[model samples]
Target: MALYKHSAYVKTSTSDEFDKVYSPGASTPHSGIYRCEGCANEIAANQGNPLPPQNHHQHTSAQGSIRWRMIVYAQ
Candidate 1:
């Protein structure tokens, strides 16, 4: 999870972007912390930038694909 000490520097939103999942190497829709659906690993990505490639990490057959979902929004 994304952590911060000062609440004044962060706030919450109800954007539908948070519900979307992305593929590896795809352009990010927003800048935020993204969690991998397969292994639960997290990465920070910026909008318009490509997400990590499939080779960025390894996963077992049971872990599935390296899908990404935004969990924290950064504006």
Candidate 2:
């Protein structure tokens, strides 16, 4: 999970983009901390840049495929 020292810098949003998921190597829709759905690994990505490639990490059979979900939005 993403951590912060000051709550004043963070605010909640109602944007639908927060609920969307992106595939590996896909163009990032927003800049923020993205968590891997399968492994819970987090990565900082920038908007318009491609996410980590397929071989970025390895997972077990139980972990499933590499899928990314935005957990924190860096406005």
Candidate 3:
């Protein structure tokens, strides 16, 4: 099998939602990073669930820009 770099963020509005997308002891390990559909940025993990709005930011990309945000979370 070929090794692929896994780099993606999980978007969720609530803790329950996050849990739904990711479960404990799941095969895919949680990167502790959550991406916001509003802005694309990397936020520090362990910031706690239901991350504060102040933690998000607008990330820029070559293909225009997106409002995706990210934060680290426990697995």
Which structure among the candidates has the greatest TM-score? 2
Candidate 3 residue lDDT tens string, 5-48: 55553333565434433221223233455554443344333432
Give TM-scores for every candidate, taking all chains together and pairing residue i with residue i: 0.88, 0.93, 0.28
Error of 1 at 22 (Å): 0.3
Q: Candidates' lDDT values, in order?
A: 0.92, 0.91, 0.38
Task: Report the lDDT of model 1 for residue 30.
Answer: 90
Across residues 1-75, which tens digit of lDDT does each residue of candidate 2 receive? 778999999998888887988899999888999999999999999999999987899999999888998989888
Name model 2 segments beyond 4 Å from true. Answer: none
Greater TM-score among 2 and 3 belongs to: 2
lDDT of model number 3: 0.38
User: In model 1, which residue pairs have backbone atoms overlapping below 3 Å?
Assistant: none
Tens-place lDDT digits, model 1, residues 3-60? 7899998778888988899999999999989999999899999999999999999999
Q: Please report the candidate that would top lDDT against the real structure.
A: 1
